[model samples]
Target: MRDQTDTGTTEPIPSRLLLGYARVSTDDQDLTNQRAELHEAGCTKIFSEKITGTRRDRPELARMLDHLRPGDIVTVTRLDRLARSTRDLLDIAEHIQSGGAGLRSLAEPWADTTTPAGRMVMTVFAGIAEFERSLIVERTRSGRVAAKARGVKFGPRPTL
Candidate 1:
């Protein structure tokens, strides 16, 4: 015979489980590899998405974040998978930090936000990402100026 216990007698849930998030920019990009890696990393639940990184809102990502609890870990294949810009990345990091959850990047193990060292590495990465964006903007501006000087007409042609 089996003994019965009160509702509070059940085993407590494991709080350190891994929650994986896999994202691809286009339909052509596959999530197979990322899923496999995340599974191997011991992810109990995996959230996936096929959408542009430039889009500020991602349904799967939001669902994943909502599912996360304190002490739970969020895993991704890469830092870029989490965000397209440094600001977005920082925002996500802040959210995780405030929620008492941890962020882990499989490709970039240094991005684990569970440790002090990981925070430092992410800080540097954020700075570099911002610098790269600035460089791209500057180059685009210079190219537009040069094209204008050369009388290279830009934009669409006017209809007759």
Candidate 2:
């Protein structure tokens, strides 16, 4: 039997399980809304925690990642709830993909990795972001070189 996903696209879902991830930055923040949203999205189980997204050592995230099995689908209310940055998201997504799991972002439809089109979009985005980073580094290096040529010294201003 073909399973249907929460996206309502009837796109031939292959996963046997749906898991959700919800996160907040602080104890003062509530996970109620995110939990409810995830439930509405048809997640059978949800992993949540209150921790700053800046730290890459989130325990709950790691736990959820480890809990993944083949043909499992991970749903998130938003991509930001899952990762701190695009690179972080891509890395996590790659890990999930490597384990035969898929990722779907409720807010960002294009970020879904369950379809060929979505995977292509993510791959292209990764390449573009890398190229942009390279260009930025090149420009910064050139600027530094030009500044050095003009005798603009870098580093500390020297002892008083």
Candidate 3:
């Protein structure tokens, strides 16, 4: 009689787990739609939370990241739900990649990190987002300068 380990390697097959992450900016927003989409996409596990994406300390997101493993894929309904800025997205992507896991966005097909083309697209998107932020900052600074020249006080008004 041949033992199972004698016929093949002792290591078991690595399962490809799809982990979903869903978020809402505020308590009033519902995660139902995101959850439904993730479920339909075949996510075996899901992590969700209601918090501003700008905050650095997101417990659910942290938990999801910690739970990730090799051969796992982190799925999000949209890019905005996962991150508030390009830097944040890049950081999250780095963490996912470091763990040997992949990232995928349902709304943005090009944001997937499992393929070479997808990785290139994500880099391009990050650059675009950064450029857009810089433009907004420059415009805001110009507006501030114009307002200052017009003698508009920016601080709190004097006592009534």
Model 2 off-target regions past 4 Å?
1-15, 152-160
lDDT tens digits, residue span 1-160, model 2: 5656788656764556889999999999999999999999999999999999999899989999999998899999999999998778889999999999999999999888999988998899789878888998999999999999999999999999
> Which numbered prediction scores highest in TM-score against the true structure?
2
57-112 in candidate 1: lDDT tens per residue? 89999999898888899999998998887778888987987888999998888889
lDDT (0 to 1) per candidate? 0.88, 0.92, 0.92
Residue 85, model 1, lDDT: 72
Q: For model 2, where is the 10-residue window of minimal lDDT?
A: 8-17
The CA lDDT at 116 in model 2 is 93
Residue pairs that clash (backbone atoms under 3 angstroms), model 3: none
How accurate locally is residue 67 in candidate 1, as Cα lDDT from 0 to 100? 88
Clashing residue pairs in candidate 1 are: none
User: Where does candidate 3 have its weakest 10-residue lDDT segment?
Assistant: 1-10
Residue 39 alpha-carbon offset, candidate 2, angstroms: 1.7
Compared with the true structure, model 3 gives a TM-score of: 0.72
